[model samples]
Target chain A: MGIKRDISHTVWSVRGNAVMDVVTRSLEPLIAALRAAGYTVVGPTVKDRAIRLTEISSAAELPDGTGDVQEPGNYRLTERDDGMVFGYAASPDSAKRFTQPPRQTLIRSRGQVIEEVEPEAPRIALLGLRACDLAAIAVQDRVFLGGRHPDPAYRRRREALFLIAVNCAVPGGTCFCVSMGTGPKATAGFDLALTELAAPHRFLIETGSERGARIVAAIPHQAATGDDVAAADEVSRTAAGRMGRTVDTEGVQEWLPAAHDHPRWDDVASRCLACTNCTMACPTCFCSTVEDVTDLSGDVAERSERWDSCFTLDFSEVGGSPVRGSQRGRYRQWLTHKFATWYDQFGTSGCVGCGRCITWCPTGIDVTEELSAIRYGTEGPSCIR
Target chain B: MDARQTGRRPRLAVWKFASCDGCQLTLLDCEDELLSIAAEMEIAYFLEASSAPGPGPYDLSLVEGSITTPEDAERIRHVRRVSRRLVTIGACATAGGIQALRDFADVREFTSVVYARPEYIATLERSTPISANVPVDFELRGCPIDKRQLLEVITAFLADRRPVVPGHSVCVECKARGNVCVLVAHGTPCLGPVTQAGCGALCPAYNRGCYGCFGPAETTNSGALNAKLRALGMSDPDLVRVYRTFNATEEPFRRASEEAEGDA
Candidate 1:
């Protein structure tokens, strides 16, 4: 199922099929319809003082009336006066954590006989996904599925996914989805896209697929007028305009490759804690290592795939030496890979501008500011020296 | 066949000097992998887990703790001679552990502080890492080395290859877990950016700053971080205390602490 563009409430599929816009008073029926379709409804919920994307059974499970105040390394939940459903921006974790768990068992063996495990990808209806994350999922799809030997597990999970994209009503302090040209609006890669129009307390729904259309038709809904759809479009556009940061992606393709010798890298390394926090918080950064495990008896053994980061010296360990031995080298490697070399390999920029890397960086080391420093030769702070 | 019904298995031994025995406990914590490793190798000697001590000239030696006494200093040399590959495990064996904080103070004062008869308590003034006394082939870092990493080192020994261990900063792990930066957001003093990656950025996951249990990253930029900390309202004493924790004796942290003290 896919979503196509139209300022009007008409949504289209890949085959040029269109579905009319429908108005729903509350998000309660949508949740019920998704669950009734044998889908595990997963969305954002306030838990442990953070908006966590988890299994939600009803609208009450979502962070209703709650909004997030997010900045570089800061987040606080505030009560919204509007009581909007999609009040907050994206969480620290996108949809990647579930798709790629920190640890995943690959092979279970007894003695030398390796056994194949059963693949069970449940029907997961991902709700409240932002446009940047949609772009991230597309990138992950390319990395995990477009390869010669597709990760069978990731593929299984992808094939069973039912995407429900949400138009971001409010942009976070660190959001740069507008600069990335990825978000504020759910343009594509969704079976259904929603826009919350407050005050009237109604939702403008666009069914992007036949399944989405059927589901929308089943739920109690009224035909949306042109004004309602236009208001929905305005919400996403305003969110884009509200973004505080931007990455000059156009010049990064050229400047980053030539930036290997830039003194700015040394400057960044000085401030950089070399903590792997940025990569872990990133939605598209997919590096991993394998671990072997055996029971106490030594009879049963298993090899598990664990998430890894480039910050580790061993990530580049060879001949008892790490190629990127210095923080400068490592930081340069990471930023270059994300902005420059990724295009050389993937034909697209690696970062989605989700701003998780910025918000979660412990040091508040803004990637946008760092990239600008390297790009424009205005290395902001030489505080270390 | 040793124990696994295969060809001659590799010999493994465990040794301790001056430590909390935490790293030794980590080796035992490899409950699942321990049996598998035992099958592939001969558990020649591990005094904590087994009393059946094996002779030297062993294939792999996993040494824990630091050299505190003259006997420990001398005994490690013998261990180095017997073992083909000696891998130091944890902060004690790699960076002199928390006990190395005493290296900055008078050893006699410490002895007097603990012992009733000061003459009876014997220890070297400086509690040094295994590598300081003898050449170590590898160092598996951590207060207690990560069990999976320890397993990987052992497996690497058997396989005749270098273990894939990242010496990158703990920031990498924190990012990988998608946690918010405590330093930037809450102004929590974090050593993650300069500390070597291990323990999966655990402290930040629970909303606390890293204690640098894995030691400093390769060529740590504590200078920049110190400047940042000053901006965060961290007093000079707090900065000094930050650096003088578990792995205080490590070069980068030691240098940073000294600089902070100087500033104070």
Candidate 2:
């Protein structure tokens, strides 16, 4: 699924699809329906004092009446006045956790016998996925499935996924989905798109697939009026205005590669720990490395594919020495790959402006600000020399 | 016939100097896999397991702890000569352990205060790592080297390959495990950004900040992380104290701690 030109609810209404209005209480039934169809329903839930994507058996497990306060290197859960499901911004994790796992054994061998390990693709209905993450899933799809040699494990998991995208109402302090043109409203790539409205406490659902319609049909939902559509549009419009950050993407694809020697990289490198946090938290970054391990007897061996980051010195290792030895080169490679080189490789920018990288960074390094520094040549206050 | 086909197991020796013996205990803690490891190789000289000492010309020597005494310095050199490959295990052997904190201050004063007879104690002024005394083939990092990683090192030795220990930060392991950033989420002072990837990011996973047990990563910007920690209300003393734990004598942590002390 791709980002649609028009995000207005009227466009979806005009497409002859039923705009169904379901109450906050109907979420339990929606979850039940997904589970009844042989799916392990997963959604955002409060865990470790943060909203983490995990398997949720009931809708009550969702972080209702809860929001989040986020800044560079900071994130705190706050209690909201109204009990609204999907009240917070993007979770610390994204759809990638389900689509592309952190670790998967690809091959296993026992002495003379060798076997390729097939991935266990359980039908997972991902609920409360924001548009930024939906877009990230699309980027991953291009990375894993679009190319000539498609990753079989990624393919199996991707095919089994049932996406349920949520239109973000409460934008996090680090969110810049508006600037990226990827969020505030779930435009596409969802089986069912939901916009949670307050005061009346209802969800305006727009079914994107036949499977979504089938599930919604089973649940008790009313045919939404024009008022509901307008209300849903207003929620998205307000969220768009309240975006915590913005990136000027104009001509970024052309100039970022040429700015390799720019002093901003050295500036970022001084602050960048090369901790691999930004890449790990990033929704769209799909780099991985293979690991081979054998038992003590050397009889049983396994080759597994695990998530890797460009920040690691070993990631750029060639002939026993890393080409990007300095933190400056590593950080530059990551930033350039995300914003500029990604377009060349995958035909789209890597960043969805979800702000996970900003929030999760130990030093609070803002990617948007970094790009602005590169583009405008305005060096921000240096924290360290 | 090859060594494996001829049923000639390689001799493996375990050694200790000045440490808590926790790293040695990690080898013993491998309850299930210890038997398999024993079956694969000859457990020639592990005092922790058996009293019977084996002959020299050992295949591999897994040394634990630091060289606090002059005798240990001489012993490590002898160990290097006898063993085909000498792999130093844990923070003590690799980075001088927490005992290396004496490197910053006077050891004589401490001996006088603690010991009844300071004259009886014959110790070096500075507790140095095994690498400082002799040529080490590999240094397995951690406050107490992880059993899994220790096994991996042994496996690599048997396979005639280099051990696949990643030199990335604890943040990589923490993020891979899908744990929330304790430092970022709660403003907890963590060494995860600079600490080496090992122990599966134990502290952060349990909602506590990293203590740099595995020492600094291959490439670390502690100055940057220190700035962030300072912003989170960490004082100069706190920075010094935090960096001066477990693998305190490691270059990056040692330098950072010294800088913090200087700033203080």
Measured by TM-score, how close is model 2 to the native structure? 0.96
Model 1 reaches what TM-score against the true structure?
0.85
Q: How far is candidate 2 from the true structure (C-alpha RMSD, Å)?
A: 3.6
**B103-149: candidate 1 lDDT, tens digit per residue:** 88998998898889999887899989999999999999998788877
Candidate with best lDDT: 2
Instruction: For model 1, report DockQ.
Output: 0.37
The 10 consecutive residues of candidate 2 chain A with the worst lDDT sum are A1-10
Error of 2 at A151 (Å): 1.4
| Cα misplacement distance, residue B219 of candidate 1 (Å) | 5.3
CAPRI tier of model 1: acceptable
- Candidate 2: clashing pairs of residues: none
Every candidate's lDDT? 0.81, 0.86
Candidate number achieving the greatest DockQ relative to the actual structure: 2
Best by TM-score: 2
My TM-score estimates for the predictions, one after another, are 0.85, 0.96
